[model samples]
Target: MVIVSVVGGISLLLLVFLWSIKRGQKTVRAFVFLSAVADGNSVESANELAKRIDLFAASELQKKAMIMVEMVFGGSQLKLISHARREGFDQ
Candidate 1:
């Protein structure tokens, strides 16, 4: 009984961890858009946005993939802007 309970608890925790990562990526994307607004984005609003996105995620793997995509590609708007600030792009 003890071993079974321990395994169940660990499994639940793992699920939560994956969900949080997916939710965090949604927060980042929302923040990027909110930053475009004249007023600054609030932490509360960002958290709410994350919750909505988490609920909308189709599956654990899909959620994880979305987060990875946002990090590597979707969030490059700022990186490109910063790179453009520098001098000519020559190798």
Candidate 2:
């Protein structure tokens, strides 16, 4: 029973890890697509965005990517701008 529970817990954790990676990839792709649109270039595809996301998903910019993804998808830009102002990003 103990061994089974241990194995189940580990399996759950692994599933969660894989889910997070997939979610992060989706967020990164959305961010890239939005950025490309804002830059007036409509040539990017889903595969290209996926490749870019994979490249940065495990890098040091993961945190930044998460922040941007949240800002864009969560509609937190105004809040973030206010927070940044208070935190001195304006400086």
TM-score of each: 0.38, 0.59
For candidate 1, write residues 1-91 as lDDT tens digits: 9999999999999999988765554444443333322144454453344345443343433444445346754754344223322322111
- Report the number of clashing residue pairs per model: 0, 0
Residues 1-91 of candidate 2 have per-residue lDDT tens digits of: 9999999999999999988776555445554454454565544443354346564553544566567748554754444434433432221
Cα RMSD, each candidate: 10.8, 9.7
TM-score of candidate 2 to 2 decimals: 0.59
- What are the lDDT scores of the predictions, listed in order? 0.46, 0.53
Error of model 2, residue 19, in angstroms: 0.8
Candidate 2, which segments miss by more than 4 Å at Cα? 43-50, 55-61, 75-91
Best by lDDT: 2
Q: Which residue pairs clash in candidate 1?
A: none
